[model samples]
Every structure is written in structure tokens, then in C-alpha cells.
Target chain A: LFAATTVMADPLPSWSDTEVKSGIVAFVETVTDPASDDYVTPSDRIAVFDNDGTLWGEQPVYFQFIFAIDRLKTLAEADPSVLSSDVLTAAAAGDMETVLAGGHDALFEILNATHSGMTVDAFQQEVAQWLEDTKHPDTGLPYDEMTYQPMVELLRYLRDEGFKTYIVSGGGIHFMRVFAQEAYGIPPEQVLGTYTNTEYAMVDGEPVISKVPGIAFVDDKEGKPINIERTIGRRPIFAGGNSDGDFAMLEWTTAGKGPRFGLLVHHTDGDREYAYDRESPIGRLVDGLDKGPGLGWTIVDMKQDWQRIYTGQN
Target chain B: LFAATTVMADPLPSWSDTEVKSGIVAFVETVTDPASDDYVTPSDRIAVFDNDGTLWGEQPVYFQFIFAIDRLKTLAEADPSVLSSDVLTAAAAGDMETVLAGGHDALFEILNATHSGMTVDAFQQEVAQWLEDTKHPDTGLPYDEMTYQPMVELLRYLRDEGFKTYIVSGGGIHFMRVFAQEAYGIPPEQVLGTYTNTEYAMVDGEPVISKVPGIAFVDDKEGKPINIERTIGRRPIFAGGNSDGDFAMLEWTTAGKGPRFGLLVHHTDGDREYAYDRESPIGRLVDGLDKGPGLGWTIVDMKQDWQRIYTGQN
Candidate 1:
């Protein structure tokens, strides 16, 4: 009964009493214990989390893509030429079939057009306003509220134990900066992701940084590790991800010479949330799930492991 | 006597009783005082410092360029054909006159050839080993040991007030990361600078990030603010710098809507260190000095402001 009570008090409250949960608890304990040989210093305790499917609902396409489509519509109303581009037209019409058929190049065009050419402040204000007014179509909850409750607990727990948590996502860096601190307690400086090129210029006697229409970097798959190296300069001790897009980050992190933890949030709750793997077009998990055992990465079964998904908090 | 005792207890011991020193202290106090309207939350207290002349010595030439020249010499010994390239030959001969004669393009070629194509770990190991072995020719001290004592105290003071200090420089990001934590208390992750392109690949079933011979980004002049926005996603409240290279950073930082602080480290003690601003080949400070008063930037004169320069800690 005492053991059961203590287990209920686990740092990860939403996580059930499974090997996956215990693994996280044990890893944190060993690395944080001052007397332990595996103890990692506070400065060295960096944990990187993927923000999309891993932390929140990314189904039916990424939240950023939705924001981009909405932005395209707004721009088209003011300047109809924005809709002349095939990709922008397809995106505004909600035709995912056509949008995906054009592939990544088309995606880049749409993203660059929607995400750039504005003052940094104006872009941030627009993103903040959109987040405040919009909701997930399926959940009927504010997009920020769609964040996984278990992952939020994990982030807080790690920070409580002196780890610096960072969101290394594929979303636009500035897009995440809008609500990341309010929603996740991670600062803007700690959020690293795909970037739009920006230029500094004196406009009307005021210094302003304007976003240019191009991708500076893409933080996905193999790009994750490279971007991490470029920005963070230190390899993360803990890597949390949801799909094959994060496989390289986990691989690079776990390969480091130290006690490391790699977690893959497997979507297995079709009733509570959307269950997905392998065949999902958005964030496929085939390669990572197949090699999870070999890589010693914990495969978190959402249906069995999580007691709840969303906790009604931003 | 009481007033003198208070002066002795200054947070910046190396800085004399000057307006520049008082400006820093007053700014910190107001922003940290909870009762003050100017009070900034600890999370928003981001401070960025330039590396070369701001933190350490950059006398004869920038230190990283010296490192590149040394690397070229070593590489040329192994492969004589390395010297066949005009830039490589000039660099290996320690002929700065000839190297600079070829201009910025030649400089980039030399930097790329010397700084890329190795595994990340190997490059870090080489840098670490070089820092351990080499010393500055003029100072007869390890390059890291040549860091300004006044700036180090300022860093500690800011951190003591809950400010997160970051090194924002035009120097090679990886090169600075090798000794940044040891030389100054700033960690690698907190340091932002110019970067070499990198790629993640599986070598012998092990993941490795290899540096590619290309300029990914240059954190100089106009590039500073853009890169800062991309990586940090925050507009810094305090920006410290030493040359025209840091002009854009200072401009962007001071232009923010707040009680912002901008500092320029002006080297004026040629006897103690080296001082050749404006027309100096390295770390020129002309436009910044002319615009300093208008921007309300605090200029620290090494001759009059600092009681001591290098403390030889690193």
C-alpha cells in the first residue's frame, strides 16, 4: 500500500506504473544523484523535446501549416496576387491532396510566402492573435490546450531536477516563440527550429529586422542533429520525440558517452486521441518504432501509459 | 571613509568610479528592484557580449584567424599540395600581409579549408588540444588567459542579478565553444556566432555530424540581429561589443522597447594592451564611437575605466 501510494506520487503523474515510466524515473534519479557515478551536472543536463506530435496534437497536418493557410487567406483578401501561386491557392482551399502532391518545394513556397516579409513584431503579434482566436477542429479546444498533459508534467519534472528543457521542433522558430513560454515554460531563446531568413535595415529612421522570403534552416530528421550542433553546441542528455522525423536526434543523443534517455511517444489511443504509426502521412513512426528496442528507446504506448491526454491547461 | 568602503564593495572591482561603471550598476538595480516600474523579470534578462576585443585580446589579428593559420601549417606539413593553394601558402607562412592582400574572399577560402570536413568531436578535440598548448605571441599567455578581467567581473555581476549571459560574436561558433565556458562562465549553448555548415551521417553504424566546407552564417554587422532572432528568438535587453562588426547588434538591441543597455569596450591603453581603433586593421571602432553618445551607449575606456586588464585565470 505504501509502495502504491509512492508510485502514485511519481513525477510523471499522467504516466502509469509501467517499465516505460520506471525507466524515466530511474534515469533521472541516477543522473541527478550527486554520489552516483552516472551523475550529470546541472549545466550538462540538457533535455530536448520535439514540440509537434510529441507535445501536442499534430494530426490533420501541423498547427503551423494551418496558421500558414489562414495567413494566406488573410493576405489574399488584401492582395489577391498571393492566391495566384498554385500552392497558396491549394492550401487556402484546404486541398491537402493537391498541396502534398506538389511535395516539399511547394510546401517551402507556401511557408516562405506566408511566414516572411513582415517586421518581426508584426509577425509575432499575428501569431499570438491567431493562437488566441483559433481552436483545433477535432478537439474544439484552443490549440495551446491540445498539448499532451503527460509531456507537460515531464518537462516540469525535468526542470525541477535542474535540467534545461528546450523545444527543438520543425515548426517556425518565431511561430513557436509566440506562446512557447506561456504554454510550456520554455523561453524564446531555448526554442530552436526551422528559421526564415531575416535582414536588418533602417526603415523610416527606425531599425527593424524584416523576415526575407526563404528558409534559413529546417529542423527535421537528419537536420535535427545538425541544427542542434549548430545552435545548442552541446549534445542533449534526454531526447523526446514522436516520429521518424526525430529518429536522428535520438540516435545522435543516445550515441553520446554518458547516461542518456531517449523517449518516443507512440500514438496508440485511437479513442482518447488519434492512434498512428508507420503509414501516417504526416509524421510516420515506422523506422523508429522498428529499431526502438535496439536503440534502447522507450516506446510510450499512449493508450496504456497515459491516464489522460489533455489536462485543460495552456 | 564609509563612501570609500562602499566603493571598495563594487560588483565590478576592475572598473573605476566612472559614469560608465555607475550606469551599469544603476541599470541592474532598477531592473532588478521589484518595486520599480523598470523592473524586468529574470526570464527576460538576456545579455549578449561580443567575444574578440570585448572579452579577450584581438591585437595583431583576430585569434580565430591565427588558429586557422596554425591549422594550415599542420595540414600543409602532412600534404604539401595544401600549400599549392595561394591562400593556404600565405596562411602557412604566417604572412598576414600577403593573406590580407588577397582580401575577404581569400580569407573565407582559408577559413573554410582549415575549419571544416572533420567529425564534430575530432574538431572539438583539436581545438581543445590547441588551446591547451598554444599561447599568444605578444602576451606570452594562453589565449583564454588574455580575457579582460573587467568584463569577467561584469559577467558575474549580471549573472548574480539573474541575467543570462551569452557571447554573440563574428568568431567561429565551434572555435569559441571550445574555451568559452572555461575562459568566461558562459556555456557553449549560450554562445552564438558564425557557423560552418554541417551534415549528419551514419559512419560505421554510428551517427556522426561532419562539418562541411561552406559558410552557413556569419554573425557580423547586419547578420548579428538576424542570427540572434533565428537562434535566441528574443530581443536582448543588454548588448556589449567592441567594433563596427557589432554595430547592427547594438542598433537592434538599443532600439527595443524597454530600458535597454548598450556597452562599447574601447581599447585605449596601448601600453597595457593594444589600442588602434578607427584605422586599425583588426577590431576597428569608428562609426560606433561616433554614434555612441546619440544611442546613449556606455563607452568603457581601458586606459581610464579599467584598473586591470587580464587576470590570467584561464
Candidate 2:
């Protein structure tokens, strides 16, 4: 019995027995062992991670989109004329409530000013700095540190088992590509997300990638699987996500021919993290939780399965 | 000399000697011979070919768009209600000149009805059959048979040298992905072009890909290199085309490190094929031809370099 426990002991050093045994360790062992029926080859071993809630905290609001709204407010305050003709009228009439209510197009107008014209390196530095200083209002922890510890452990465990991990999210591609490699160890090329138009130009005889304001791609909900197929060209063996936004991607990945795994991180630890599903506007995990059991998906109960919720001192 | 020529004889049996010796043979020998300075590794051997004029004839007009227009006309004639309000209005105006000038938005409305609501396989089969039956109005040969013999030989030769070939074009991705494999021997996965939105659905308990019109991507002019970088990740070592539309692609491909090859097929064989450049609306090889020597690009004079234009016997 002791040997059996040891064999299945928590692989993640920083995590508790319950967290390791139930959440990531058991899943990794079963999926990685060649002797097991669920074994997958390195080439076929692909793991996709959802960004907002699964990787970082998305509590009252999604941080990046909030940043864009804040940017719009600041720009409007500084120079009312700087806002687009439509956004200007909206701002003047206190219509910030419904400014992004026009959906993707409205969101584009907000993000265009917030993100465009910066060099790739400069944009990345700004993101890193913002992450370092910004704290989740609810958690009172740096935004980066608010990432789910159990999920981070799962990411490492998957990588250790030769899985090529990628961040497939509704976040901006260029924005996510900037910090993904350093933050998650997933390379820029592997990070696939929504993208605004970009241009390559010579500035002072040096090549610079410039961000331009135009709709290049939108990787959301149904768009998720399409973007993944268009970019990766291979079906992932394992996919981990916490929201309904990732439901289609999970379905697409698990629908593959061979052994596949889909794990939904249910935010059940309300005290430790925050718990709201289906009704929540951000990171809604309703559809995934509902369909998970019937589809053979592992629904991760954060309260029961994770000993710790955040990195650095919680 | 005879033995060398025999050994170097066109790998594509259908191609003529002038076509083989000048274009295909030179590419193969330069890229495949390890002893040669120009030799490229299998992994590094990336080749890009323009679709419209370079692979299949785009003369008279872009054939795929023409097919869409004809399909639109037939649909309108049969059931007036099938035409969108805008399309019906455009057609009822009875101006071929106005219809042609309506551009992409008008075409999209027409294609949404004609191209959508079918399985990917079914759509591909339809396109393949169309190519087999449809003949160029001027040339009076099947569209597939109207493909340039030298370009076809070059494609096979490059593939034999272990190159991963891609068709980068202004054509629709759905349209090109259909017949490119059967006609050009370039697989659907290897073809990059303009794309419309695709929706995934379960039809009779099985996954089916369906095309919905509305531009998802446009692979033309500056967009060519951006799409290549976004989709392929790897830059090409060799690129071939016959139009100013391909100028940016050739420039971008040649800008990469390592021994690069850029070839522009100049239409100068009027007796055998249409001859036009600079001022010609279709397949204009202007800037590329003028800057070929300066940019170290190889210029192929069709009349001088190709012994045969099309594979079909006239």
C-alpha cells in the first residue's frame, strides 16, 4: 500500500498530497506512461491552456479589457478629440457603459488606441511592468501571482512529460505572444490568440514590427477551434481550460481519434479564489461543467483538489 | 554532355526541354546537390509559388471569381429570390461592367449562397469537377491543362529536392484548397490564400467543415507575407510568380537569411501564350522584372525559356 502510494505520490513538489494526487499528478501519470493504455507520443502530446481565469485571475473584470477601457477614459480626459467620432460622443454623454456594448467592433476601437504603434519589445516591457505592479482588487495579489498554482503545476507536469504546451486564448495574439514565453515557458510562435493588424517597417534603418488598428483575427468561442486548426494544424492530446469560452476548443481537442484528455478547472474555491459560473460575464464555466462528465472530461474541483491557489505569499 | 543532359532531363515527362533546362533543372540542381554552395537542407527547403498566373492561367480574368459570377447569374436567373437584395439590384441593373466593378463585397454576397452549406469534401469534389470541365474562353483547354508546363515541372522538381512547397495567392483559401492538390500536387494544408469564415458542425453525428463567406483573411500584396508568417511560421527559401502582386512576397522571401532564389516568369511568348507586362491588368510582371537584376532575382522570359506553354496539345 505504501509502495502504491509512493508510486502515485504527488509529483508536484510545492503542492499538497490531495492537490497532487487528485488534480495534476494522477492525470499526468496516466497520460504519460507508455505502459498505460492512455500513453501519447511526444509529437502527438500537445497541451493547450486558456489564459484569463485558468492562467491568471479574471475576477470582477478581465484585466486586459479593463486596461483598454481605462485607456479610453484617460485619452478622452486628456483630449476629447482623440477619441473616434463615435467613441467621443459616447464618452461625452457618459455612455462608457455601452461603448463596448457594440461587441467586437466597439472593443476594437477601444484597444486600437490603447495598444497600437508601439514596437514589439516596448509593448512587451509595458505588459511585464503592468503585471508586476497591478494587483487583483479582490485577491490583493500581483496580477501575475494570482495565476492558479495547481494549473501552473499541471503546465510544468505536462511539459516534463514531453508535451508541447500552447496558450490558446481570446486574448490578443501580439499581446499574449509578448509575455507568454517568459511567463509560461510557451514560445511566441505557440501562442495563438486574437490579433490586430501589424506592419513591418524600417525605422532609422532598423526593422520594427508596428501594431496597427484593424481587425486581423478574433479567437473567441467558436473562433477558438478554427484559429487553433489554422495555426497549429494538429489536434492537441490534452487541453486545460476553466471557462465556457474554451468549450469548443475542448470539444475539438477531445474529439480527436486517439487517446485525449480534457480537464475543466472549476473555480469552486470561493474563499481562496472566487466562484461564479454560468452567470458570471467573465470566465463562465457553465457549459463545460454541465457536459464534462458525459464527455469523459475531468472537472477539477478547485476547493477539494488544490491546497494552494496562488503563487508568492497569498 | 549527353549523359549529363539525360540525367538532368525533366522529371515531369510532360514538360519540354527549354522549360526543364531553364527553370526546373536549375532549381533542383542548385538546391539538392550537397557539394554545391547553393544546397539547402530538407528542413530549410521552402518554396512558394503564386497560384493565379504562375500555377494555373489567370488570363482573360481570374477564373475562380469568374466561376462565382457565372454561378451567381445562373442562380439569379433560376430563382430571383435566391439573390440577396443587393445582388438582385446589381444584376437587374444589367451592366456587365457594373457587375465586374462591384468588387469583393458584392462577390461575397454571391458566394455565401453558392459556396456555403456543403461539407468540405463535397465542396472540394465540386471544384475538382469544375476544373476538369471548365475551359479557358481564349485557350479552349481545360483549366487544369491550361497550367504553365514549366511551372508544373518546377513544382515537381522542387518537391523531389525535399522542398516543402506552398501556394501563396490572392485567391480564396476555400477555392484554392479545393483543386490545388489535384491540379498542382500541393496539398490543402500547404496552400495559403484568402479565407472566409468556417463553422464546425455535427451533421448526422459526424464533424463537418462548412464555409461561410465574409473575409477571414486576405492574402494579397502586403498581406501575402503577413499571412505566410501568421500561418506557415517558416519563411521560404525560394519563391516564383508572374505578377507585380507577388512583388512583396518575393521581396520578403528573399530578405530572409541563407541562399535564396526568386524567379519571375515574364510573359513574352505571344504566339504560344498571351504576352503582356507593366500595363496589363492580368499577371503584370513590371516592378519585379525591372528590379530583378538589382534584387538578384531570376527573370524567365517565357518565349525564350519555355519551349511549351501549356501541357494540352493545341
Show model 1 residue runs off by greater than 4 Å.
A1-8, B1-8
lDDT of 2: 0.73
Question: Candidate 2: DockQ?
Answer: 0.13
Candidate 1 chain A, run of 10 with poorest lDDT: A1-10
lDDT of 1 by residue, B1-314 (tens): 78766644578988888988989999999999999999999988999999999999998888888888888889989988877677778779877788899888888989888888898889888888888889999888888899999999999999999999999999988899998888889898989999888889999998999888888888899888887877788889999999999998999899888799999999899989997789987999998899986999988899999999997842
Which candidate leads the pack in lDDT? 1
Candidate 1 lDDT over residue span A1-314, tens digit each: 77766644468889888888889999999999999999999998999999999988898789999999899989988998888777788888888888999989989989888888898889999999999999889888888888899999999999999999999999888889888888888988889898888888999988998888888788999989888888889899999999999999999999998899999999999998898889998779998889976999998999999888985742
Lowest summed lDDT window (length 10), candidate 2 chain B: B14-23
For residues A1-314, write the lDDT of model 2, one tens digit per residue: 78766664344654555642554556666777989987776766888888888887787777787556555666678887777668645744558567656765666777777777676557667777667666667777766676677667778778878988888888887666655666677766578787777786657744345677776777888777787665554568788788988888888888877777888878877887788888887787778988877888887777877778886554
Best by TM-score: 1
Residue B192, model 1: lDDT of: 93
Residue A81 local lDDT, model 1: 88
DockQ of each: 0.88, 0.13
